[model samples]
Target: MAIESYRLNVAEVIEETADAKSIVFDVPADLQAIFAYTPGQFLTVAVPSDQTGLAARCYSLSSSPHSGRHQITVKRTVDGYASNWICDNLKPGDRLRVLPPGGIFTPKDLNVDLLLFGGGSGITPVISIARTALEKGSGKVVLFYANRDETSVIFARELTELAGEHPSRFTVVHWLESVQGLPSLEGLSLFASYFGGYTSFVCGPAPFMKAVTTALKELGVPRELRHQEKFVSLGGNPFGDVEEVLAAQATLAEADDADEPDETEQPAAPAFAGPVAIEVELDGSHYSFDDWTGDKVLLEFLESKGVDAPFSCREGNCSSCACIVLEGEVSMKHNDVLDAEDLADGIRLTCQALPLSDKIRISYNG
Candidate 1:
């Protein structure tokens, strides 16, 4: 049978760090009977909302399949809907609709040296891979975990013990962002060095990954040797304030205005008609909604029909509502998730998508 999204009951909640929590889910019998996943994939969790709060968010699995339970670690991001809600309201026995694990972050082979870097809550999948690699004795591993302070570090003791037990095969380094006079990497093997023989993996918030990748590039690390995982939709803007956002947007606008448009631009059309049939497939079922004049987006249509579709940041910044257009063409009013290749391949974010054709079919299961 084809796999589809299923609702898992929250069985236990464990506080992993100061502001982070790990939630274990009770897998249903049918799902458990056939469920299989790699180490670094993620599951999209849908938290029911009153149509006001932000929608569902995706969290990577912190625990590997070896643990025999599905678990996700969430950091309480400032103004994060799913993260904050899971921390505050979600308790044992609560049910959450969870999409199956999906992504390409998992290690493809285990015969090479692994260099892992994580910051704050981004340690989830890094730890999972390290643990599994060590257990299998697949390769040598080094982990660099950075956080605000020692107390904010999640899985500190466990990671320390793992490194201690496998001194020659494993190494763990901790960096406290709040600590001044921290040790410099003059003598130590910093990730920037590429360390001679290592397949580097990095996961963190966007800025952290960018800095690390920049350093890695400066160190002459080959692109294939470096692997980075970034959560697309950040919970909060670390830069802060609407003024900064507007300023940045102005800069982008200036840049775009300076660019020359292609001569192949299509002529602008008049107003679009509606009451079109927008068909979508979720979990093998087809849902059709009448697209009225006011209904301009696929997400709005889905929500209006009470489809319980997974989403986050209805502004189209997150791929939580990403789907493939299996049959018809749709125009994006706005989208930040898909790259050029994805758009060429017909993947679109339903949040910012509008049907150009009267008939459309989008599948979130893809």
Candidate 2:
């Protein structure tokens, strides 16, 4: 059987709010015949840069399927490559290659009242749900949009218009942090009083998300009613700075096979000439190899050197061989892990990892 993908024609582009733009696409006659999506599901957009094939990024649809137009809102981030490209280059009538919608962020039923919270650009998916709920006559809806300032608030005008049109059905509040320095929940409390009770959907960056969710719980909100949508998954403490753990593992590995060393243990390592490990330490195991190998990734070189590195989706999809770079640098052919903060702190996905220096130290955390 052949795999399926969705390619779309950009029909319109609307400037939703400052720093955010909404792109509407026509579901091609051929693809629309097979395309169906849940309200909160996200689509991965494949954008090719230079001569290389393409790089993909997932963005949530901001428009309701009931609206008769399929659209997604993208907020330009200062340092993000894909986001910046989309904002500056994408225009009306441009073509976009897309994957079918996939995500479990949408709420199933609309039996109860809903409280929706959106921080900055995270308003995209929440907007979709709120609109869908209204169209389906799904009880009362309250929306709280929090942002750095009014200047950067996305969908502000439309939200305001929506509130005016559905005065009794929906309530909208804007929380300005730049001028107000953290909003007092006086507005939200007033809305809650009208609804009796409601389920909450929240979305935003790490700090913003953590704060809102924490506040909801502390204010005696029920956990069952709270639904959160997060794009990046920083898997627990295992992947965080754990160089000491890697060093300890290397120590154990060294002790185990030091007495009866492998063929490349002594000197003049090997002849493959890929990402050579000048030094290796993990779980008390020590295996040293050489550098200067062409077209071989660090993880590949480690396997060739007889070090069983735990990894999956070597293209950098699963973040399986994610590790802390204790010393030296590595070049990645591609990666989804290691954001700006992680990269500054020297974390890398070992699958796409390539040695930039002759000597490098890594940990499996396996």
lDDT of each: 0.71, 0.68
TM-score of each: 0.64, 0.61
Best by TM-score: 1
The sequence of per-residue lDDT tens digits that candidate 1 reaches over residues 146-187 is 888878999998898898888889998787888733323431
Worst 10 residues of 1 by lDDT: 234-243
* For model 2, the run of ten residues with the poorest summed lDDT: 233-242
Alpha-carbon lDDT of model 2 = 0.68
| Model 2 agreement with the true structure over 63-95: per-residue lDDT tens digits | 886776688998887787677788888898789
Off by over 4 Å in 1: 1-3, 52-54, 180-191, 234-366
For model 1, the local distance difference test gives: 0.71
